[model samples]
Target: MRYTSEDVGLLIKTTQYRHHRGLDASLAATGISLVQWSALREIERNPGASMHRLAELSFNSDQAFGTLTARLLRVGLIERFQGPGRVTHHRLTPRGTELLREGRKRVMKVLVLSFASLDEKERDMLGTLLAKLLT
Candidate 1:
């Protein structure tokens, strides 16, 4: 194997950061940050999911997710209701659903542009390798 000064791990991290930044920038006009959109998407996926579960799915701490939920509530993007006992569940409001739908379009464009350098086979291979790493 050929040795190089740059670490592959760092390269992967930087690539991910650039991709996230690109997506976030593309979503600026949607009135929600990537983090908020991500939480909304998670809520849509797991309707009636508790805040803790949503936080985990969205890669946020409970407190952070609570703050996010509060903001979304203020903006009327999401609503919360008591489940059983102290547990609370969330759902996307109609506005939230609309924003999420629009955000998907913007994110898709950014992702496509980001991977434009990679051909179909290479993109498939890259996805497989990345999924393997996660596993």
Candidate 2:
């Protein structure tokens, strides 16, 4: 049977779904969803990102991101402060940083196992192809 572009697309989507499920399972002990982890990582990297900016970065609506932030705040994982323009700036708390560190350890294990079948060159080629697709 000949494979078409649609076949490749479906495979890519299925791979993504599987990866997401694996990551969700890995993160279950931490009590955070993939979306929450992504927001935390973004805030950790950005230091003082605004809610609007983070919402944009996370591809979430303002209200949805707001709810996510509220959950983070309630869990003692992050703090929000007043910024210049009256926008709230988010920063990871010490607890948040620890959670991220531990979460990354778990995620790295899953990633390493997931890519174990790929040698270095194959990994590089796959990475390049994925980057090209993104661009």
Candidate 3:
């Protein structure tokens, strides 16, 4: 059977959905969604990053980032402080750091399991192709 471009797109979307579902399942025990984990990971990597920058990195709108950060704050996982030019700087709290460490391990386990069937060369090729697609 021949596949059209739409078929390829649908396959990609379905793969993404399945991957995210797996991630969600892995993270459910941690009480944080994948999006929240992504935000926390970004903050950990770029401490004192501005809310705007974090939003951009996370591909979230300002309003969405605001809500996400508020939830993080409520959970005592992160702290935000006003910085120069009224920008809000974000940093992971101690609790956040600890959670991130655990979460990273969990995520790595899931990733390893997901990619277990792909050998190193295939993984490299897939990464290259994905990068090309992004560009």
Best by lDDT: 1
lDDT on C-alpha atoms for all candidate structures:
0.91, 0.87, 0.88
In order of appearance, the predictions have TM-scores of 0.91, 0.90, 0.89
- lDDT of candidate 2 over 1-135, digit per residue (tens): 897999989989998888788988998898887788878888988867777888888778989999999999999999988888877788989999988888888888888898899999999999999999999
Candidate 1's residue-wise lDDT over 1-135, tens digit each?
Answer: 763546767778889899789889988999899999999999999987777899999989999999999999999999888888888888889999999999999999998998999999999999998899889
Q: Model 1: residues >4 Å from true position, as ranges?
A: 1-6
TM-score of candidate 1 relative to the true fold: 0.91
What C-alpha lDDT, on a 0 to 100 scale, does residue 21 get in candidate 1?
A: 96
RMSD of each: 1.9, 1.6, 1.8
Clashing pairs in 2: none
Score candidate 1 by lDDT.
Answer: 0.91
Q: Which ranges of candidate 3 are over 4 A from the true structure?
A: 1-3
Q: Output the lDDT of residue 55, model 3.
A: 87
CA lDDT of 117 in candidate 2? 98
